[model samples]
Target: MTANFSGDNSSTDLLIEHRREIADLLQRIKNRRLQVFGLYATPIALIVTLLAWAGSKIFIWLHGDTPTAVNSVFAAAVFILGVASVIQGLAEFGSGSPWEDSETSVRGLKLDLSLAEEKHVLEARRHTPPVSDRQASYKERIPGEIARLRKESRHYRRLHLLMQWLLFISSAAITAVTAWYDPPQPAKGALIGLGATVTIIAAAAGYFKPRERAFNLQQTADSIEQHTTALELGISPYSAAGEEENLKTYAATVEGLRAEQRMREQQLDQPQQGQQQVI
Candidate 1:
């Protein structure tokens, strides 16, 4: 009897340790995700500032001596406007609480599991609803959340595209005004037009291309929520055990999706960098 009791205690300790390990892993993944999101605004901010400064210089060169003070004020206003746009973009990109959103889903699953475990321990609990009912509730909430996230993503994408096009149009208009007044030497005019055309094309492509990793991360989170609910309700018996398995699956899927997204983002960055290099 003594040996049997000792064996039981040891098994219980091992289970506790495993649970702690899983929790740690999940926390690490979440931290990494938050860090990645926080850094996303930096590059856009730099680009906006650089473009504004370049545009201002071009305007000055084109206008020459006429209304010098007015031109300077206009150039300063354009720079300020560019800075404001960058600030606005950063706020929009980061304001959605993506990390919080993901964490909320994870917390919901954890709560359900904790309640289920507590009921199992109590044994005398008679009013507890069946797992199936709990699962159904989860499923009902998930689709709405997924739909909301998809809508928001689409809206932001469109907004970003609009901003890119607006920047290109503004740049072209400035260039045209400058050329009309200053009339760049034939060779210079040709080069300027070529450069502006290339920049616009590059920006358009970057804005429209699918952000593979971000899309993947979002889908993975949704899938994890769905699977967690299914597993808890015994509607779908996954290969792995408990909430930990669901979390692991979700993290793995997110990592894979993020990798692809990062690759695409890098590709987008390259063309912009190349353009800057030429300038």
Candidate 2:
């Protein structure tokens, strides 16, 4: 049963190709997770500050002329939270790259792939049922990637909902304060601050386009899922004469999907026009 297969060149090249693809997938997963973290974390920080400030205001109303310790504690909490929100937003926007950790993993994997010699690859091929096993492995990879994108899309959708709530609540509060209270100078300043806060949040939402991004990612993931399902069912392009032929179809189609996903990710990374200042 010893068929004289192309020994080193073709097999090694194929291994390298799959390794690079998996590396790219790892990178995509990492970037999307970081994107979810930053997108949601910034808003959570701001929301915490709002809640704490409201609580402090209620405390002041209930017990007028509070002690210095109480005032100092509230002031300190606000300061810390404000600083945290600013830092997180800056890190997310343009100040830092969140993909470094994933890139490190990719580098290590590539090194291992490079070290794989002809005999080593050949031995692996000899031991394994080549076409079916490799096709199954490839099939396994697609779902994980699609799930990652879908998960990130869910996070962004939640964020979009929360931002809408923030905008409405802030607007309502400002309107209520204006109608109900003939505010003193300080109260007027507070009202103005609330208005500014609402405006900034709205601007950020429009600039960031989390809703749109969520929609786009979800659509992309769905498209990938469809292709993967078709391949699994031996439909259309995936209907091949043999296991090897089908494997080629599967690999090529998956690579095309991955490239499309990468392009979408690049679009996600770029700041949309007219949003630069807000960004």
Candidate 3:
């Protein structure tokens, strides 16, 4: 049976607007973070480029071959441009991301939404008579939570696979490039640095262990699905003569699975270098 959760039109509209605003704000925050990261990375990129350029220049000097007028002018211009860019990036990066205001707003809106939702629920209960305890659960909670778990699992799975491929490809490229250029050229050094960047990223990914998160989430999702299907099919746990008892069992099992998944995620988030235990 479907659950009727709506209150009055106005309250329903307010809830909808609140959700829309929250989504928009979250998107804005994500975009802002990306922008800030780009700004912060710019100076590091400039330094790497300058280091490569200086190395190339040093190699030329060691050969006792002076640069042509045009080559010297070009190198000078490039160095000056790189330096200016580095300064600009450093200045902007020091200001850091302005996340405080937006995050504060998000928190305020969430609190308001919680209070409004509680009031809305009370209004709904007052207007519509008492409902079956399972009405909301059977109709909304199970499906929503299952969908969320599936989506989170997929997201983490994809991230883990992508990072795994990066680790593999970067290691291969580093070896291949080193063999390809026996000479110590700046270009080769820059390529090696790029490969090291991938290694660093892979190390960070390892620490986070998206694979474990995906495993735990998928396991929880599968568990929930299995119990749901058994409950619907009136199998062992649900075979009892009492419908309420079956529903209670299903609720308890699903909650337990969810709690376990949350704990697994927290353990994965710890700041350790060791392999995470996938529960």
Candidate 4:
């Protein structure tokens, strides 16, 4: 019964099939990157918080009182634990795209195809899902696209702020601690964790570049809105006599912008892409 419903794919069908897979793989790669970052970042954040709590307690205990043998013991313990945690984080999460190599290899597998390999793969890929016939009109979808892009823009903007502020606060804390006074041994050991925190945070920032994402998303949304407005007003290129043609123009422009936005995001997610200046 299953075989009866399935049709063998020709070269053309295989081309379409591979193209769709590539697009889906690209999206999955981005998702994988985010998941890996969160996986490492969450624990690192907890470690940082714990270090701050420990440091605060140490400071409060030492503020006016003369440093005692007991205080040194406690500080040493905190220093050992905090520094270990931070080093672990830097080792694991210090930021080029994690898990990206596997995905890239998968993509390479897809690209390095042969006629024989394609045939073998096609034998298993014959089961194609039915494409949906019902679709939302541009009128129904454009507003939603505009809204989504704007919302994502805001989300990335907030992320940018959070990462930036964390880096700033970490840097200032490190500097202030160094300049304030000569620290006794235990406190100095604990402060090393703060420095490591800054390294991890900077690595995350450079890799993610959330500011670039926010800007690109907002730019795409704005361009889409501009096209939408022009289309509705029937002005210039959209001034075609037929409303259908005007709508077509708007759809093309909006989709092109959306595609560009997705490309920009892919660039942001790739560490090597960071070397190139973002558009």
Best by TM-score: 3
Off by over 4 Å in 1: 1-128, 183-279
Worst 10 residues of 3 by lDDT: 97-106
Cα deviation of 268, candidate 1, in Å: 16
Write model 4 residue lDDT over 86-124, tens digit each, in one string: 655554467663444432333454454444356546644
Q: lDDT values of the candidates?
A: 0.56, 0.71, 0.69, 0.68
RMSD of each: 17.4, 14.5, 10.7, 15.2
**lDDT per residue, candidate 3, 25-74, as tens digits?**
56655655655565556556667766765776687666666468746765
Which scores greater on TM-score, model 1 or model 3?
A: 3
Q: After superposition, how far is residue 189 of candidate 2 from its true place, in Å?
A: 3.9
**How does each model score on TM-score?**
0.28, 0.50, 0.55, 0.49
List the lowest-lDDT window of 10 residues for candidate 4.
Answer: 127-136
Clash count of each predicted structure: 1, 0, 0, 0
Candidate 1 residue-wise lDDT, 8-98, digit = tens: 5665665565566556556645764554454455555556656665676677655655366755765676676567556544544556644
Q: Show model 4 residue runs off by greater than 4 Å.
A: 1-136, 273-279
Tell how far residue 277 is off in model 4, in angstroms. Answer: 12
